[model samples]
Target: MPFRTSGPAASRASLPSRAAGRLARTTWVDLVVAAAVLVLLYLTLRVGQGTTVRFSTSQSAKVDTDPARLPYDAARSLLRMFVALAASVVFTFVYAYTAARSRRLERILIPALDILQSVPVLGFLTVAVSGFIALFPGSMLGLECASIFAIFTSQAWNMTFGFYYSLTAMPRELDELSRSLRFTRWMRFWKVELPSGAISLVWNGMMSFGGGWFFLVASEAISVNNKDYALPGVGSYAGAAIADGDLGKVGWAILTMAVMVIGVNFLFWRPLTAWAEKFKNEQSEATEVQRSYVLDLLRRSHWPRLLGYVLRPVGRGLGRAARILGTDDRPLTHDPARQRTGDIAFAVVAGGLILWGLAGLAEYLHDTSGLGVFGEPLLLGLATLGRVLLLVAAATVVWVPIGVRIGFSPKLTRIAQPVIQVLASFPANFLFPLAVWFFLRTGLSIDVGGILLMALGAQWYILFNTIAGAMSIPTDLREAMDDLGVHGWQRWRRLILPGIFPSYVTGGITASGGAWNASIVAEVVTFGGTTLTATGLGAYIAQATAGGDFPRLIAGVAVMSLYVVALNRLLWRRLYRLAETRYTL
Candidate 1:
């Protein structure tokens, strides 16, 4: 500051031995988590492969089936899903940065994001299949590559939202500290934002995977209007068995899905939970410690050996380079004459849109596919719009009070969070057959089945996020409200409602997108080959996929996407802005 305090700053900056001790304690926890996960994985593989691990389901017309080879299938699916997940992490960071801090760019980003999310995964399959085939003609691997990209769409959006919320809601002091340091963009992102957002993003990732699994059957097993392509996967296998009413394979699918979910939770989630705990600023002194596996592994490993190697000449050289380049904790300064660029650079984005549009058009026009039979764009648009509204209303009405109640009560919040997490993780497709059975037995309209399927994923988005928002309300504000004798409707209107408004908006945004996904199953049902189809965009796209009409598929997707974009821009954006100004500080 005023006095040159640099001589003492180095001493002040150094961490004490106790910090090292605490770190070591955390490392031990990580190793234990890692070992448990590894053991579980090995056992699941063995059981899934073993001759003794056999089960049957009603889907196979009550016939018994063997699960001896499911280990191979599960392993393969898990590997691919993990790769897609990693890619999702990268996409989320980019999305979060643009959405949270960029003023003008956020305006464009939020709507564009809404559209991107609203377009169903099935729609991506329709567009991607033709593109991949063209990208690598006569290559079987090309088709598989296309399939994985479809999966990416399902996983990325929720992750993006998680990062967006974390960055936007970062503590004010942290914000000032970042600004004062004049940290480079990369440094700020890596050192500050990433840690803050990681826990929420990880949870969102888990939820996204659950959402993705709902579409797995349709994604892994490809079909467009009788031109069917079944890629070798548990999804394809499950789809095949389901189509033929192979109940035994259904049992195998259920078992495999359960094992994977539990295994993932134990391995990936446990360590992340531990690391995330470090980010919390305590309201009270240390009470209880949560367990972590990765921390354990980090401790027990040959860290000393690694550190010794790193402390040598080459490592010292690298460290010096890092310091010189302002890659360490130093501030970076650009020349005053060189002005900083505005966010996202709108001109660049416009150019990108043009290029993307051209590529899409070029692909569609060259194919010479008969896309006309898929029906009118106006009809598709109206159908999708109706479904979106219906689903949002349903989710809103159900989750609002539930979320508010959970938020205001700490004990209730803790209990509800885990329940919601489990429900969110359960794939919606698990309820599909049950939905169909109930509807049929009750003589309910086929449309109700579609709504139920859509609600399955969309409802959780609102419920869970609402609870999160509620639980996060500052203790002081709650106390002030209580002291004022606020209760019932007045309490909700002034305190609870305003407190959770931002989260409610986010939940609505996510729920609407989920509705689109739910439509894939909801609008197009194939119960015993007597398809009960809804009159909507989803049905139109489904028909195109079944018919191999790529052009019509693109048209349907485009129309639906445009509608989504328009609604988000005109309606949701206004609501989001209101939330930001009125509720968020």
Candidate 2:
């Protein structure tokens, strides 16, 4: 040894060299992360300035289509989506928890959510705009809130269903344990219910985010009561480009949206998805864990460590505050008589509201064009239903096998998951020009082309859920199959199909709803001065909205809602029950 360094003086002398060595060892990841941070900071500053200047006056104006302003516009759009997603999460927890925990509440809440889910994207925007404007009068913030709420409607319902399903499906043993421990409501939610439901919530949240993107154009480019309102965003950019027949701007907007979607998948979804796997109730024999380099970097980073150290006291103080505010653990006693009376009252009120709504709808339609007008809408509904069923069948046949193959392989899943997710989140309308062009060029029927477009937006639901189901299959079951030499169609029919049936049903329900929603945008495509309208319910609703025919719009939406709810109750619900009884792991 040259010289022993043991004293404080020696340690102090080594610090500079150690720091230099560590800095030298930094990889390209660090540089990339640094660049990203700087870019984000610049964008934030630019967007902040733009917001103040743009919203200074109360007048609503058209969004600019300048390529240079695209970044700021995209930032604003993303901010709205993020805000809406946050609100959806809060709503999902409260709404789903209530529905799951109380039988009395569940009777009312579940059907309410079902009807809400069936409500069209434009319906939400049409109903919400005036209320939101009144709430935040004389400010751009009001329109912003309305836009966010529209996106929220697209996102919230499925997430609520996911959480509620997870909660109700919790293992009996876990429920008994919580009750035996006399856990406080907060404790039960935080420690038991939340964790148990978290994986489902995350998956549904991803799907909801994708659904929001599908409706982004409608939400941002608000057209209600025959008046068009445009916000500065990629959605508005695309809408304006389509209206002007500017293919160049449309191309640019598409590219920008793709980049943003990829960035979001990597930065947020990848890490969250990896983290959520840990919350799954069943253990697998697979040794390899889902990995996220971003998450790993943050966990090991020096800055995060220092920040944690600084905030340690604050965290402790908050913990103390939480304990002080915590509620008692005692279980509440139920009165059967009171519960019965409450149920009866709720039923009466609900029945009255339904009858009143039907009367109003009938009156409005009669005043406008009479009940004879219902013929066209009912025919459109049947056409759309045929397309939905056909597309769903096609998707199931194609994706189920592919999804299972990928899900069963860790290496493949690691590679393909993010790509599939980003693709799913891509707004289907971005391809409208290409689709319209193809149909126009090839002389194909617009009806066929429209159904394909609808399928593109909806099929990912089945794919992703199939993957989730396959991944959840126990290793022991797989091993047992292998040992028994079960293979080919026999193995699939006996094991794999049954295992994924529940997930497939969940996905199918959502996919069917999404297909219906997508019809609004996909059924009618306009590009480069060419317009194509497919004959269906989507076109019907789109026409009504465009013409400000409120009665027709409401009627079309109601018919669509009825179809969706009826299918859920008659078909999917039965399948779900079968899955629970026979296939649940």
Q: Which tens-of-lDDT digit does each residue in 513-548 have in candidate 1?
A: 787767767787654454567777777777776787
RMSD of each: 7.6, 6.6
Query: Which residue ranges in model 1 land beyond 4 Å of their true spot?
Result: 1-65, 99-108, 130-144, 169-173, 195-199, 270-375, 404-422, 475-487
lDDT of 2 by residue, 1-585 (tens): 597778878976775666566566666666666677799788767665543333422355477899998987889988878878999999999898888777767877887777888788888888788787777666667678788999998889878877777777667688779768966566677789898767667777888888888788899998887778777889988888877878899999988887887788888877887787777555455566678878887655444444555565565565466467654222246677887797899889988988998998799889987887777888899988998989899999999999899767877877887688667877767787888779978999878888888986788888877887776676678878999999999999988999778778778888888888888888888776788999999999998988888878888888998888898889887887787777766
Query: Which window of ten consecutive residues has the lowest lDDT sum in model 1?
Result: 55-64
TM-scores, all models, native as reference: 0.75, 0.85
Pick by lDDT: which candidate is best? 2
C-alpha positional error of residue 286 in candidate 2 after TM-score superposition, expressed in Å: 1.6
- Candidate 2 stretches greater than 4 Å from native: 1-61, 301-342, 367-369
Residue 62 CA error for candidate 2 (Å)?
3.0
* Model 2, CA-based lDDT: 0.80
Q: lDDT of all the models against the reference?
A: 0.66, 0.80
What's the count of clashing pairs in each model shown? 26, 0
